[model samples]
Target chain A: MSIKLEHLNYIYSQGTAYEKQALRDVCLELRDGEFVGLIGHTGSGKSTLIQHLNGLVRATSGALYVDGKNIYDSSYNMKGLRAKVGLVFQYPEYQLFEVNVLKDVCFGPKNQGLTDEEAEERAKKALAQVGIDENCYEQSPFDLSGGQKRRAAIAGVLAMEPEVLVLDEPTAGLDPRGRLEILGLISRLHRERRITVVLVSHSMEDVAEYVERIIVMNKGSVMLDGTPKEVFAHDKELEQVGLAVPQVTYLMRGLSELGIPVRRDVTTVEEAREEIRRLLKRRETCGQAAEGQ
Target chain B: MLRDITLGQYYPADSVIHKLDPRLKLIGTMVFLVSLFLSHDWIGYLAATVFLAGVIRASRVPFRYMLKGLKAIILILLITVVFNLFVVPGDVIWEFWVLRVTRQGLSQAGFMAVRLIYLIIGSSVMTLTTTPNDLTDGLERVLGPLRMVKVPVHEIAMIMSIALRFIPILLEETDKIMKAQTARGADFESGNLIQKAKSMVPLLVPLFISAFRRANDLALAMEARCYRGGAGRTKMKPLLYEKRDYAGYAVLAVYLAAMIAIRIMR
Candidate 1:
């Protein structure tokens, strides 16, 4: 129900001329049913860190524990660990390879030792959850539209019934509408299932609106970790590491600097709008009292 | 784990061999390979060995790095040596049930092993020193005469260079696809040989689709830029010969002559 990383360090091509320290002492704890957004620029070790959530990539030094069990141990069940942590990679649509969409979705559950009938049932349910119609189930996965193919790929992971779902830029390369659709689908999945969701994204606005907590990474280390409001409050530090606060937060800060006496920590447009309305109402009430006196 | 491949990898350096004209290097490699076959005795092999060593030293690429490329062909090297050791008939030096070792067999095996090792090293020296771009340009120029007979020399060179460029890219893509499937509980390991291959189907299909998609996009991009084959095409870094290239040819000529002399003496 929890994944904890302690002093994780990963080096690419260790002992070779091309050796690179990709992760440097990254420590994090993701508990059950927590919606966390991992934000970092390119090559900030976001992908590498998430791969360790499961047993896909081993850390050069450190302990990775899943549900209080040390997964880095030699005797750990890597297959079971993978099933517990379902990861959807960027442009996951390319991983779809079965003759039909339903079969592709069944690959994960089948690999987990499910019977064909059971796998099919799970796949069907997962597909429906992703909003893919039953009619598209028997069609070739390649024939689906880009968004549908991506959804089918996500279903392939969801069929495993994982306790933790880690998605790496799941909405990348999609149009604005497709982006919203994918994000909404992920938000709904997190709410209904209460699963630990680790969303790795580049879009500040999307991360601020969706996740309950935010973790900012810089050069393979955690730069900031807190709720959206707490993390966005360190706007200057975030910008120094090639990242920016959400657009709404910037607008709110600008209004505060202009002497509007509004909160500067608003992370979403809705919050900014409410703050402005409150400020205007207070001013109007004060003005009426002064005129009557 | 897929990054161990060193074959066809270029080693950048500021050395005479790296700066030599690509055409000269190409011809020099060809001559060296032909000389390896022409040599008939140990004396000839000794001369070839000395020449190869000198060229490798001058290339400035680490010897160990060059030998890494030979790891892929070690099995083939062993098979050839073993075949020569038992198959050649001559005065028997040792014998067993259905296995006999002869002086001629022993000599042949020794010669075969040396020739195979030297052949790989010779080619590796060329590829390691020259960039793929220069190699393709050299190939096109060397085969330019074939265009008179309508052989599409430029197109062939273009295909080769593109293939070389895509090797690393395709390796990266394969790694990503494998990880994606593994994250979904796809067991690539802990399976029998057939079962393991069956698991690769998920990896292969997506790879092929992406490769074709990339190729299609590249073709469209090229055509959009008004690509029209080899007809009157100009080069950005045209091939030019220098004093060092002349010196390289002279060295190649001397080696070939020595190899020919050894052949005639036998």
Candidate 2:
């Protein structure tokens, strides 16, 4: 299902001294089956915007539609909306409480009204999809290693069979290998399930590598929204908002400045590598032609 | 929804009450609470109400915010009112079966409700204006004489300060956990009492675990900073009474004397 936020605004602790506008007229659309990365500085309202997709937070003065249904409407099915848009909160492992990992994963599906057997089936499938071994399924979630617990917690949300998955910093606090594993798992899921995925992250490199589109938030509004190359092209603007282009984008820009004639907007290492190779090949052909001359 | 809780929350403001020594506010709140129980008459209540209103105005905290703290004790308030209204024997003003609303009962209930409300607001005024650290400092000093009797006053103060400090953090944690569980489709709003209570499992388990984790982290952090039971500790901003604090003490004393005079005259 596609998600659309129209002029959405959210004010926390409204009418009080501590009032803060966490989201300000945020207008965006999440098209079906697209992997989108949301990057923002801390307190930039990225979390607030994502939470609106599933009716977790009602906009203070705007509207949200999920698949053409106004979620804020009194008759809206919030539970159904939540089921369709699985949100994996940061450090989701803290939400685990069941005796075993398998049971914990089943919590979401069961809350969705699935029978024990059906919930278990879906839970097992989700665990396997996240690469959790069957042997660890019966162990307590707290006993699992940090990475494994994270995956298991994610499986709990996956068991709900959401058409759209919103993850807030899924790879935060993980080791290098763990980060790669989690990102790879998320990319694989996006590819196989054809689900619209919204990943909120601080790592610009990871976002550039994995997501098809990027949305940058600053002070509670979308500062930039485009393909990774298009977004990263505004490197100075990103930096002004306490964000940066992917590391490879910087290297590509540095290379172009040094007169290497590489594409300045390259966002990934692979793209940079191919760009340099093509430039070298062109140079070689030009050199041979000069020798013939 | 959890954020609606205002108990023990400090409302930051620059006002005479906020700047007064925490010791004075501490003693003042105690005196006010004692005065609340000093008389059951409107004259006494009138004095207390005026005093509380004056203090709240001096603190510059919005009256609505102070009243928010009363929301948590609403059930207790209702229980006390109901019991006082019906159980006290007096001339009957209204009667239905075993439930009789007595003339004296009516006054008693009204006074009890007022006292309960004043008690909450009066105490919250001190907390709302004073920082937890200052309050603990005042408490440690006020209770210092007991130290000679082997009371671990400083340690007790440290614990109180830590607990006060964690109130907001834990409330924030609870809010996060609730949202996380809600995102997972846990229905905390619907269903029968049993089901509603059952839904709390997802929220409470995470909250307790996170709280314990945080406590452990805090302990490690404190230990790393070489904290050794508040021994040989000097205040970063030691408590000092200002001219306004002396004036506050005089006002408290006058309020207390009025309450006592009203009780004795009655």
Candidate 3:
């Protein structure tokens, strides 16, 4: 297993009047090189769970083992673990603070104890990988566009060369174009770099298009974990938890209800396009065969 | 994890104290605070303690929460006790290098600690019972006379209330920034003092940026809603005193009288 959580429970402000049970006995094991999409409504413990993977938030009652080491154990070096599992927080642009874009991206590699040359090299490669222009490197990170700033922030984490990358709502609060740019960059990074990615998002379409495995969270527990095709099949149950499958999935299901022989498991536009094309070709062949008869 | 701060935080509940007029509650708290320092003997402290306990029980806020406020002040309490112990010259009981513990110092230290405790608890009870909104309203009303001196009392109260409301939001933002930095291998705990201070640069820079953004958004929102100033602005729920407020004042008067009587008898 790459990351393991056993009966993880986290209660915010425990024993106080404002005590809130944010996570409740969550047990999950993520294997190596798995692209997992964690989907949930607000306050469903999705952020809290990803924080545990990198040891940012400790499990209140249970054990979390990252790469075969119990993170909460006293002897375990959490700093090394943090470097091993990079987390890009929500609105990551807000976390970009260095004077220049290049320097900001170098923060992670430098913090990981890399020498100046090596850190600079890693930062440059990560920035290039995220498609930030070289001319923008010397400009202040605060001066970058929203999407560029977000990319720079991601590059900061990418520079750390983490084994597993966890991002929370990476495309939130962006325009359609900016959203596509950032998500495409992340998808490319996952595809080419083969980094294990855990994307915590509310956008079912984004999750459906990208991830192989989907974990549905509700009320601080994992309600469902399966392939996107399987998880999105429980449309009514997901709706009860204030969530839903992708719009394309709903469209395919609607087409089937209208007496079209379309597959309901279709999630992405490409998948729906292929299925509809196949259905039309089958009809054309059946009509030709009937005429031949 | 930073959200556990209950200091000066209002505890929502239905009780006699919660129902009293904010103006009366503010004035009562002031009187109680002043009366805490009026007594020099143990009898005075005892009377103050009894009055506070009675008010706390009436407020219906958990005593445990009130005491939790004391946790944040433990260092200040210790410093005051220690400073008072070593500085006050009197009948010396114990002496060391540059430090003297005297009978008067001991008694005075105890008095100071109790006075400080009573002060904190009294103010905490007031704040716990009254919300930031009501407190601002009460402050503006109580300081209305200062407007004649061109003090901008309403604006000041508005600023105070706004700052109070943003404290928790900023703290949560700060916690998020800290976690983001930590996830990037920023070491906040294991560093030396200087290293720790330097590490905070990452957290603070982001927090300040977000705070400014939030403030800008809030200002735009207020302006868009046509919020000009407090001039000629009337409260939606204007402050009004019911019979219970008068009764609360009468009880406060009796408590103050008991405190004065105890001081005089000693």
The per-candidate TM-score of the B chain, in the order shown, comes to 0.92, 0.97, 0.93
Winner by DockQ: 2
lDDT of 2 by residue, B67-118 (tens): 8888888999999999999999999999999899999999999999999999
Docking class of 3: medium
Rank all candidate structures by their lDDT, best first, as comma-separated numbers: 2, 1, 3
How do the residues B88-111 of candidate 3 rate in per-residue lDDT, one tens digit apiece?
999999998888999999999999
Tens digits of per-residue lDDT, candidate 1, A40-140, equal: 99999999999999878999999998889999788899999899999999999989999999999999999999999999999999999999999999999
DockQ for all candidate structures vs. native: 0.73, 0.83, 0.76
Comparing candidate 1 with candidate 2, which one achieves the higher DockQ?
A: 2
Runs in model 3 deviating more than 4 A are A287-293, B71-75
Q: What is the Cα-based lDDT of residue A2 in candidate 1?
A: 89
Best by TM-score: 2
- Residue A8 deviation, candidate 2, in Å? 0.8
- In candidate 1, position A273 carries an lDDT of 88
Candidates 1 and 3 compared by lDDT, better number: 1
Candidate 2 lDDT (Cα, 0 to 1): 0.91
